[model samples]
Target: MTALPYRPCAGIMLIDRHGRAFVGQRMDSTLEAWQMPQGGIDPGEDPLAAATRELWEETGVASDMVEFIAAPDQEFFYDLPEDLIGKVWKGKWRGQRQRWFLFRFLGEDGDIDIATPHPEFRSWRWIDPAELPRLVVPFKRALYEAVLAAFRPYLNTQIGIEAVSQSDRPR
Candidate 1:
């Protein structure tokens, strides 16, 4: 029996000041839903570093404009179709164990440029946090919910401030 191969990865759930989270629409494909920016960790690369790199690569947001808001978390045990196992990438049966980070975007929204040399997302948007569970892939819905719940305090703080500020502004 062949041993199952596993890969370790990392990702970021970028939240903006308006209490919205970033969701990237996959390009050049038929998928209907969007997802967070994520990628595989290079050998010897730290999970945080990988998450930062992926955020920049996929969303055009630099690490300098974002702050690390939490520690690592894991989502494991995803099974790929048998035919796609070796064909997509050289791996056996095991799935990715990912560490996710939550980042607060400090840069202007216009700074996002997915049209870089190697684009991952064709388009991106800031969506409400409550909508994330329905937008992400079904297999990843639970993980997304967990991440959102873990980061809810930070999100709520920002949201409250925004509401107060908006109400205080002149009409």
Candidate 2:
């Protein structure tokens, strides 16, 4: 059935100093696909806050270690595959409606620790932003493409670096 509502979620696209996006291989999957930090938003919680928390919970990256870069004008949505629609998320959601936020990592790579209290990733690494769709699971490729397109102007560019650096400066 196509009537199930998508879960409201937030996603974090953290960019390292080299301007690559962070991706993680799922601990529960046998496939080679990877994904960024994302999770359902708690009731009454702001999406930005949810994104921040998800990033920390999944990657051990605190809010202050990164600078907010930019967010697209829209949210991205994707549906689960036909065979697994009822096998995930307690079979409650059709998929996710994700609000993605871009953040520039200000700390050293050592600051990142995927071995969190409750880890979801088996491994993690930074990759070129344009390759996100190819690295993600098939179901979420389109969503990743849209995210990459929306943030293309800022990713891996000197303008984006300057902008993020400027924002971190004292008034």
| lDDT (CA) per prediction | 0.72, 0.87
Off by over 4 Å in 2: 157-171
| Model 2 whole-model lDDT (C-alpha atoms) | 0.87
Q: Which one is best on lDDT?
A: 2
* Pairs of colliding residues, candidate 2: none
Q: Write the per-residue lDDT of candidate 2 for residues 1-171, one digit (tens) a residue.
A: 479999999999999888888999999899998999999899999888998999999999999998988776587999999888889988898989999888988888889899999999999998888889999999899999999888887775443343654443222
lDDT (0-100) at residue 142 of candidate 2? Answer: 94
Model 2, residue 74: displacement in angstroms?
1.0
Clashes of each: 0, 0
**Residue clash pairs of candidate 1:** none
- Deviation from native of the Cα of residue 101 in model 2, angstroms: 0.0
